[model samples]
Target: MRFIFLVLLALSIALGLGGWSAHWALDQSAEIGTVTIGPWVANPSAGAPDADPYSKARLAKIGNLTLGLGEGVQFTADRDAAGRPLRRECQYRLAGQTPAARVWTIAPYSQEGRLIQPGSGRVAWLTSNNLMRAEDNSFAIAVGPRARAGNWLATAGTGPLVLSLSLYDTPVSAASGVANVELPELTLESCPDA
Candidate 1:
């Protein structure tokens, strides 16, 4: 009886410590939501340096909790090289090694937390929506003013873009995992001239 009681006490202490550590690490990582771009870097009414203005369910993970945001990264737009409302064509690729949930989505958002001027151009790619799918059942999306046709992610004529790849329904394993996850990089192709 005494041996069992001691083991239980040790397990409780270990769990408590692990949870506390997770919160601390999260607080230290840079805020992924709020990132801004553009010339002058001052125009949006909300504020300069646009922060993460998108509405998304929190991210989840499992295992070591290591996430991969592709090495190639692209930032939001404020102005073009010529300083005339920058525009660009780009693609985003997302993948997960062991996600807790089976479904996921990549949605766009503005600084004010609203979907940009609605259009079929590119709204939300959801598993249930039955749109995005790769050969292996993974997913990818393209973002631009014009439509890429399939897997297109639409953008407003002028404003910052917040792309959120949300993992549906947080998984219990991820909650206990101690690793990071990865996100796709935004590949910029064509930016409007100055």
Candidate 2:
């Protein structure tokens, strides 16, 4: 009877630990196959055929259509330069030059992965072709609930927000790992609530 009880206790401990570990792995926001550059994080291998089990599970759970290895890489930022969580009530500026790419897009989305629609007649996303660049080719985009003078990306409602920067037909995708690429910096401009 003593030996049987000991075996049962060991089995229970093993099962409990196993279940906890599996849950922790699946719940991680930044999985193993990911690269972080500044405030942006990208899992280049998430869409590859040989992606790890965790990467595949994360993609499946999020229901995101990831860019293929040869297509491009999509970087996501949920925080500002100071590492504060991005909130819709605050204003921000995305300023910098992107890595080499045939085309790139910057858009705002809710934490649930849905696009955040702005007021009618206003653009909620910006593309590389239509932006006004500085003399040196750098660009600045204003993001907030209110409208700005130039290169504006508007958001609506109040909640946590995310920024998605998708680079298409870029050399970054062809590389095995992320190179020293410069991505835009998201700086908090203002917040009425704060």
Candidate 3:
């Protein structure tokens, strides 16, 4: 009876610790090296040898090919500038001067990391080569489930979505030591029902 009790106690402790460790590993958001601007966050070391364990795990989970360090930086926004979670129920306007880069692209993706497909003639992404810029070089793109006049990114379903912006061969540095690089602005426009 004494041996059985000890074995049971040891098993309980092991199971408890295992559960806690899995929880932490799955939900850990404290990326070792990341740059945040407004709602967008970029991790420059995603594919590098020095990447953190969390980043490696996340990359494996997402199954995304990370760009090289000089090749580009990718930014993802799951929230709005007002600290509100980004939902497909609302429309948003993304406008601003992008950082210095050879090329860039922005796309709307569902929570599962798949591209959101809305309707015909409405693309899910905008590339730097195809954008219609103003005289001063600033650009605006509308993101919604419905069609808009200019530069619209279609969101197929309702619920939370993320906007991913990738800047290729950008002069902007993603290192933690660098400071004050300009990123695009995402503003909540309106919600018809909510």
Candidate 4:
């Protein structure tokens, strides 16, 4: 019995030491994974994988991420029948329900995951209840070069575009139900077509 107890105690101590070492490595800047969105993926040659999430030298910045599409969501920019890229447009659409605890937003960003900037990457596409609603309770934002009628998502000078929908204040457990939501196919539209 004593032999068994000692063995178990040694195993526990080894595990605890390993965990602490990992934590220290992360704090000291470890490497992490690259950011990928469908066919468009960013390979960061510099960032560390085990680095801290809050560190400035981390892999990539995340402007938008979807949480409510059943389990997870898939996004592609809306494309024309010819498979051509649509500008000031959403090629991919994620259909999911937002959690009650926090607010959700679908905003445009660049391949680097930074805010698209200047327009759709601006304050228009990214909205909350603080902004005025347009008739329907559902919020809509447009992405493009010039300002449109509804929410204006400014695309600075045109690069690959991506949309990130975030659900703040949501718990990890509640996010599991997202797999059950019957999401709609992402629609292709210019500024107002969708």
Candidate 5:
């Protein structure tokens, strides 16, 4: 009787731990094959045919179609350069140059992966071609609920935000590996309540 009870307790504990681990792994955003630069993170193998089983499973759960190996690479930032969470109520500025890509796009999204809608007659996303650059070819974009002069990416509502930067037809997606390239810097300027 004593031996049977001990065996049953051990089995129950093992099953519980296994279930919890599986759930945690699936819910995590960053997994193996992920590269981090400042606040941005990218998984180069996310859309590859030879990706790991865990990565493939996570992508399937999200139902997001990642760029193919030759298509491009997508980087996401949920925080500013100082590692502070990006909030819609706070204003921010993205300044600098992107990697060597033929075309790129930047946009803000909610935590749930939905695009944050901007004010009427305002744009929600900014592409590389339509931006206004400085003399040195650098660009700056103001982000918040209020309007600003020069290039602006208007965001609405209140809550945490995520920024997506997609580089299309860039050599960073080559078969060799992800190159060490510099992405734009996101800095928090101010908040209305602060």
Candidate 6:
């Protein structure tokens, strides 16, 4: 009887642990084939055929199409360079030199993966063609509630902010086995409550 009870208890514990692990694997923090640069993270195999089960599950749960290996790569940032959570009430300056890509785009989205609506007549995204370059060939984009003159990503939503940078037709995907690519710098400028 003692032997049987111990076996049952161990089985129950194993099952519980398995269930919990599955749940956690589907959470927001769950990612496979990911690379981190500062506050940004890139899942180069997000849309690849060899994607792990967690990445496949995440992509299916989000219901969004990811770029394929030859298509491009996407990097997401949920915090600033100072390691502070990005908030809609705060302004940020995203500046840096991007890697070699035919075209790129930066956009702000809510935590739910929905694109934040831009202000009246203003865009919520910046494309490679419309970006302004500094003397050193670095670019900057403003992000906040208020509209700015240069490239801007309007944070008109009411939730935590997330920035997505997409590089189209770039040689940075996982298939190429290239890592440590140059990304942008996300600096917190100011905040209304600050």
lDDT of 1 by residue, 73-103 (tens): 2223333334433233333332323244455
Give the per-residue lDDT of model 6 (tens digit) for 76-147. 999999898999888899988999899999988888788888667868788998888899989888889877
Q: Tens digit of lDDT per residue, candidate 5, span 121-164? A: 98989999999999999999998888999998999989999999
Encode model 2's per-residue lDDT on 81-135: one tens digit a residue.
Answer: 9999999889999999999999999999998788998878988899999999999
Model 6, residue 115: distance off in Å is: 0.6
Error of 5 at 188 (Å): 0.3
What are the candidates' C-alpha RMSDs?
Answer: 16.7, 3.9, 2.8, 13.5, 3.7, 4.4
Can you give the TM-score per candidate against the true fold? 0.44, 0.86, 0.85, 0.44, 0.85, 0.84
Question: Which stretch of 10 consecutive residues in model 3 shows the poorest summed lDDT?
Answer: 171-180
Candidates 5 and 6, the one with greater lDDT: 5
| Candidate 5 least-lDDT 10 residues | 173-182
Comparing 2 and 6 on TM-score, the stronger one: 2
**Which portions of model 5 miss their true places by more than 4 Å?**
1-20, 174-179
lDDT of 3 at 96: 91
- C-alpha lDDT of residue 48 in model 6: 82
Q: Candidate 3 has what TM-score?
A: 0.85
Q: lDDT value for candidate 3?
A: 0.83
Q: What's model 6's TM-score? A: 0.84
The lDDT for every candidate, in the order shown, is 0.42, 0.89, 0.83, 0.45, 0.88, 0.85
lDDT of 3 by residue, 1-194 (tens): 99999999999999999988866875676556787888998887776777778887777777878877778888899998898888887899999999888999999887778888777777768899998889999999898876888787878768888999998988765563324777878989997765
Ranking by lDDT: 2, 5, 6, 3, 4, 1
- Model 1 regions more than 4 Å off: 1-100, 120-129, 172-174
